[model samples]
Target: MPVLEIETIRGVQLMTMNRPKSLNSLNEELSSALIRAFHMASEDDEVRVVVLNGAGKGFCSGLDLTTVDSIGEQSSRFQALDEYGWVGRLALAISECDKPVIAAMNGIAAGAGLSLALAADMRYMAASARVTTGYIRRALSPDAGMSYFLPRLVGPNRAAKWLFTGQDIAAFEAEQAGLVDEVYADGEFMPHVLRIAYDIADQAPLALTYTKRLLHASFDTDLRSQLRQEFTSIKACFATEDVAEGMQAFSEKRKPIYRGR
Candidate 1:
């Protein structure tokens, strides 16, 4: 069986980590499979939204220590964290994906698993789901973009509190802290999240992509620069057929069917 299971529902692409016996842990094979999956999803015009989840009880338990790089050689160790490595590529593939990506946490996520979720555009958690920065427990610091994305998601103070003490954050607490977009009962979680993904899919694809791009760029740019980007983006949108369809739909008081053009 594949390490990652791929499925499609409407315009939403579901990528489920399948190492269930180990709680969907990220070994080299699983990590590489995820990188390829995200890239394929991004290139497929049919995929408007992506939902990442895990099989069985736990979402992902981070690295499979038995299959990772050894710590013996300091100079070349932790190659998974290098720019071209599997873990790094997977995180970038999610964050920089043209379409919006949502992390569907069906259960617990720790270490690099939580980092992957934090890299996504949005995250939806089951009531029973939990997440933690587990590196500290292993006598290590954050990896796989955890250090970068966490502070941006929850602010420096909150990020510090969690990172400093490797505590498992419950769904309720995560929602309250803005670490997750929404939380729902475990049994109905996927259905609820799918509805949201479909609603977003209903919008013009180009508009959604541009919106995500602008949002990501906003963090490192000035107000003037962001305004310029917005101006350029809207101008570009005006040239697309979807914008015309949207306008016509508004006039007719009906939903628009965008064709991505």
Candidate 2:
């Protein structure tokens, strides 16, 4: 079976990590497939939003440590990995994706799996789901951008606490702790995620993509630099035919049909 399954719903590109027997753990094949999928989604004009999830009872269980040899055999080219060399590449792919990426985690997201979810623009969790650092238990430091994304998502103190403990955090607890955005019943999880994805996909494409870039930049850029970029972005959006359509729709009291011109 393919390591990754991809389907487009409306303008949202859905990527599912496929390895149910291991809770969709990240093998080399799955990692490479996900990296390529993110890059492809970014370049595909038909794709407006990206949604990531795993198939089966749980989400990724980190590095697939139960594989033939300590999570996976060391291929000659993969020897450079101390902690998921390819997973690092995977993280970069998601970071560079031009469209908004959402993680619709329907089950437990442990270790690097949590890191993957944390990297998304938004995260929605299943009520029965749980999350944890999943590193300290194995006497290892965090990997797959966990340290970076965790601190940014839930603040440094909370990030440190979770990393040090490696305890499983329930979905509602994660939401209360600001780790996850929202929690829904497992049966209803994907539907809720898709509903939001479609709503976002229905908006003007260029405006949405640029808005995502601006918001991501806001975390790193200075106020003056961010303001300037926002101004530049707004000007660019104004130049698009969608802008005129948006204004006309506003006046006409109807929804705008954006062709992404």
RMSD of each: 2.3, 2.2
The digit string of per-residue lDDT tens for model 1 on 190-257 reads: 99999999998888999999999999999999999999999999999999999999999999999999
lDDT of 2: 0.87
Candidate 2: worst-modelled 10 consecutive residues by lDDT: 66-75
Regions of model 1 farther than 4 Å from truth: 70-84
List the lowest-lDDT window of 10 residues for candidate 1: 68-77
Alpha-carbon deviation at 191 in model 2, angstroms: 1.0
Residues 1-261 of candidate 2: C-alpha lDDT, one tens digit per residue: 898999997899999888989988877788889999999998898999999999998877777875426444565654645454777878878877898999998887988788889878899999999988989998988878898889888899999999999998999999998888899998899999999999999999999889999988988989999999999999999999999999999999999999787
Q: What local lDDT does model 1 show for residue 244? A: 95
Number of clashes in model 2?
A: 0
- Per-residue lDDT of 118 in model 2: 82
Which candidate's lDDT is highest?
Answer: 1
